[model samples]
Target: MTLSDETPGGAGMHVHRLLDEAFAGVEMGPDQQDLKEEMRGNLVARVTELTATGMAEPAAARRALDELGDVRAILDATESRPGPGEAAWQPPRVRPNPAFAVRTVVLSAVAATGLLVLVLAATVVDVPLAAQIVAVAFVALAAGAITADALRQETTTNHPVPPARAAGYGTATLLATTGLGAAWLYLRDAGLPWLVAGALLVVASAVLFTYLGATQTNRHKAWVLRQQAPYGSDRFTEDPAAAARFGIYTVTVWLVAAAAFVALTLTAGWEWSWLAVVGGFVAMTVLIARMLFAPKA
Candidate 1:
């Protein structure tokens, strides 16, 4: 059937017209319905955004139409099985790369063990009792928050970074926290050794979490690149330096918050520390926003 016949219902008439203009010589038929639907959905989403940005309805529609180029070419490049007969075709399966999963599990386990030992040691040691207690609590809370946030992202969004990784990190954090709490209550008499062990565990957990976050960010960038590559568009190019800066800023904010927690613990005690922590968190959020929306060269 001809293009006009295939698009008979005019369900996406504007989109069809734009595609016809962009791909003047290409054939269109029922085989292309899926591609057309996908394009229409994406364009509508963009149009919604443009409307929010103060564009008039007609202007937004035109802009959305203009951005979608050479529809048949796009469909040909993006769809592996484009014909009507193969509409439900599935791609051949490939084994997943196991390195990231292996690393995540192994690092998480080691970090948890180290954090447990460190927390136990801190409790036993003759160091600043209040400071050590505060440090342990601070680490526990931060780790828990990170794990929670990661889990939320996994469940609530379409982002990369497998749910398995988030679960692994969360498990490690919980294990370390449990170990520390148990040692503090039961092995109180072991003194410095337990404190040292607990301290080590905390540090190890931090390192593991950091590695996981970095790996996750990399995975996300790779996904973005793959999505953009097929469109011959560089609108979302992965900038390693920019990503590195984002990471640095994130870590710095966390460190500052941790420091503020420790400071309040020492001076004003646990209850007061919450205020400083909250303030630090707000500052961290602002810093992250600035980094994300900074002018690009």
Candidate 2:
């Protein structure tokens, strides 16, 4: 069957259309329906495999159908199989372990709480240097542990990241947290040395992150990719007006931020000018979330 020039959905829709055509003239009872669904799953699986190997979605779907051969022959062979109400073989689903999930949650909460307490103490009260250092290390460890543990666990839609890469990510997070803590110390008049160290740590983490991101390969499962195919890469494709508005808003925000930055740099000093840039970034992010991802009324 010929695929439409533009199926709203991606590879999954293509396979679905092909499946519908294949079953068009066939009679389907509950058993047949079950078999059809099973077949659909298998077909989608094959398509996913093909796409991952660099084939286009339509080509992958076509190849999967070609490989599938005669659908009726399989049905005929399976006539004596158990009915839908009985037990049937199905694909195995991968899920995160319950223990892992709980551990991740606990560690994340611990990290968050530690960071919050540290921030509050630094600002609201005088925390001793020894206590602050211990707190920083505790929070860093928690954040790193959570990052590594979470990445190593297989999820429903994505494969577990490689251990080495996961460790690298964890290290980056640890360094970033430590850097932030050092910055806090500097803000509290700990020393200029704290500021220099914080800047170095932050820069190191940023470089590591850049390297990791550049070399990262796709970890998304085939099924997830298929599901996402329909939407394509651009979230705003379906709303040209929204896209235009976002562009306008972003330009406006940055323009205002640039003016503010200049004004702050001249009057308030460069130390405070960076806040304007940070605020601009936050505003842009909020605009994106609201404009593109907000639920339709």
Candidate 3:
């Protein structure tokens, strides 16, 4: 079924455009033409199904393509014979979206500017505390935006992370950035409140990150997963229960660390409390190594 130009805007158009890009430069033998047609039909159906479920047409088309996973693999499979010295078929590289590239550049510039302002305020310039706070917030938000946008984009060998999960990652990034900023302010002798806020934000980010890691499923497309099969999957994929246990362990570690940090701040000193955070990080690293690298049963 040819995708006619007369077809109205929606999944059909998106699918057609995608198929054009995917099949470009490939010699269209009878078998290849048939395969392309079959793929186009299947992809259109999948996109239509996805769009019916409230997904945007563009996103639906992309998801459908992602599910197909490396169109070149299928094309290679259909080849009955290889001509003499047909150079190794390399998969087409997925280029970064122009719009996304521009967005990243802009956000990076903003983040850098914010950092410059913050350093100047803290060290050389006698900028107002309010202005310094604003600079910190800007940097945090820019970082968060970059993280979220990156997660939401489809990579060469992996599908886009779900929007909700991407947003969670972004939130964690923001919390960590803000926490670092707060810690810096406290080091500048701002106040005990800043110290408390910094510690809490850091702990919160750690918890969120642990949870995300534990719950994350593989997003690699079929071809990517196949290539990785020889290396073997992670223990968490093999035993989900282990992942759950690790998540619990991580949470407990961080909570205890937070409590210790507070107690040390009260009894020893704010200077000594940071040791609690460092200890917690070391504990978590050891836990990861033990869980992920233990001898396979």
Candidate 4:
């Protein structure tokens, strides 16, 4: 099986890249797809076998590939090879990123709580303890739902979204907001202001979720870009030094942000320290943009 460097992770990609180098000056024919699939299958099979013996997957894949010798040599040797049946191969799936899932839960919980508090305070101006408890429960439910979605997105980046599933989520959100709207219109005993606040909260949460989905989708775009960028393309211009410079810039920006966060906490109290972080993020984004778009020297 041909390893594809275009893939996000592993020695499969490394082997694929080496093959690409060997393919230089060779005309790609109709069998290109078959060759790629065959190569990938063989390499992955070897990796799986090695990992079965307790080798780490990455190291096993690497070792198995290295033992196979050069990509071009393997390709030539396998020129007359027939691939295994379709049942023997399948595409890899991305696992949910645990760190991202935890972050999402924390952030969603905070945002959900904020929205609930906003709605409760605006509607009643002074909510009773029981009312606040009910609001917190509702917010907790919303937070749970949002976190589930964010965890789902961790895997979504590795594959295309199913249209029916997308429709299901869209319909669910629409129905929820519509029900809230209907209550706002018909339930006069439930103060119009309170119902309206609830509806608005639903709408705001939906928008926030849309933003999160967009962010995850953008990650896939980055993977696509990396895959498309040829290793030898402007090699001198995109060398280790350039990467090191950007790495340094990133480190420096975050360090400055941390320092600012600490300084503001000391001088202006903890409440204002977060704003310093917000400013740092903006500044760092601008700096990175400038660096990326700067005229080549």
Candidate 5:
């Protein structure tokens, strides 16, 4: 049967057709046929699930299409490997050290917590509005610095960056710092100065984390490519749909956090309460879990 026949909806069908057209020239051997079929089947299943969940057919189709990006790369990898008549393709080797991974994760968590604590404390201590603003800005600057360092390490090591890429990690850091400074000048008395400070800190932290996340994502992709290159096609890397999904997910998290913050503001009446603290913790937990456990495209 044609690939389009396997798609669940008009959009998905169109995507299936497009993937087929794009990779039409690719010549597959018996060994590669199973791999191609498996990938295609998986995409189809995912698209179906998305549609069944009440996503607009077009959106589901678009998502499915995006998830199938970089099919050509995958195809090249699949076809270039060592075979009966070809020189054996030696896969690039790079082992991720578990200790390093653990250390990175721990350090990232510690830094995040420290920054949050500093912001919360500033809000609670009834410090000068200017001081509180400065503190918030400092935290943002720190987060941005940390993210930049991480990006540098990833690039130097030839790791791929993640999807939903953001620009100017440095700029985000600087802006956050600047915002804090402004907040200090503007916030005063028993008014909403702390709220302003908290908002600036949260925005800065989000930007920093988002950049870090994208970088790590690219790194993971590089690792996977290295491992899978010798065995199968790399067609999946060409698609932009995965990154789009991640962007949507990020926005969703931000909105949820905003809602929680609003609720806390209304209930706590300007106290340095646990509303955002709890929400941030929960958001981070979910994000980490998804990153670690979600099925790869």
Candidate 6:
């Protein structure tokens, strides 16, 4: 009748399948994930003891699951608003990681210094091969660390930043490096001298900041939604309304950029019309930055 607690039975995998089936459409959070593990471990232990006591493996598993009863009912009763005997466990508050900040700051400083050296090399032609190599190494390491840290955690109990978004930030980091490098080299040939290179570098930096800031802001908002939502769920922005708004915002930005390009070409001629693209980018960057840092009241 009683089950042992030494180890899980061979029926462990089956029990997992059962649990997954029972909670198939359920939205899971960090605490819920933990509870799933707890239930799986406990049930398998019970089944193992039952089998040891001469019960068939399948029969013991069924018996244990029967004891488990309704999955939704159990989770609903336990996740939040715990009973008198249990302690409350909510998601922890977000805090800045000092090491992560250091990596970000170092990456920025290295990029600036490297660009300055590249600019200087245009005139001197002797920027030292060893220094260039060291600059490249530093950029790679610092950028990698900052990107990794962004996706590492949101709070103690939650993986708040979605994996999809994390992958995006990482991809942007790689593209940022390439874009800045290419723009620098291209402007050198375009003959605006140092100003063009500096402007391109500034644009690259702005774009990088916009991607990181906008995505991180969205991730935090999602976490807030999950914390306040009901039914043992942590899903966010899963509706058509949110999608529509995002679509509109995207379309509007591109429309403005295109309009700027045509207007500048007509008014200022071809030589300087390309600056419209840069102007539109700066405007969009300012908009995103404002939204990202807006008051959270």
Q: Who wins the TM-score comparison?
A: 3
Which has the higher lDDT value, candidate number 4 or candidate number 5?
4
Compose the digit string of candidate 1's lDDT tens values, residues 267-295: 98998989867887798788766766666
RMSD of 3: 14.1
86-126 in candidate 3: lDDT tens per residue? 52332334778999999999999999998998889778898
Superior by lDDT: candidate 1 or candidate 4: 1
lDDT of 6 by residue, 218-258 (tens): 43433333333322221213343334444456658778888
TM-score ranking, best first: 3, 2, 6, 4, 1, 5
| Candidate 2 lDDT score relative to the true structure | 0.77
lDDT of 4 at 113: 72
lDDT of 5 by residue, 1-297 (tens): 123334443543544564565558777675445445445555656767897889866566556757776666766665686574462322334566565466567656655664565556557654454555555555555555555545544432366333234336645665665565455445444357655764776587577757555533334433333334334333324333455455667677877877777787888765744567677778868874675456656
Q: By the lDDT metric, which is better: model 2 or model 6?
A: 2
How many backbone overlaps does candidate 6 show?
A: 0
Query: Model 2: which residue pairs collide?
Result: none
Q: Please identify model 1 stretches exceeding 4 Å from their true place.
A: 1-237
Give the lDDT of residue 92 in candidate 1. 25
- For each candidate in the order shown, give its overall lDDT on alpha carbons: 0.57, 0.77, 0.81, 0.56, 0.55, 0.60
Count of backbone collisions in candidate 1: 23
How does residue 292 of candidate 4 score in lDDT?
Answer: 61
Best-to-worst lDDT order: 3, 2, 6, 1, 4, 5
Cα lDDT of model 2 by residue, 86-190, tens digit: 434433357569998898888878777777777867678667777777778878888888888889988755799999999999999988989988988787778
Q: What is the lDDT of candidate 3?
A: 0.81
Poorest 10 consecutive residues of model 6 by lDDT? Answer: 227-236
Candidate 1: minimum summed lDDT over ten consecutive residues — where? 1-10
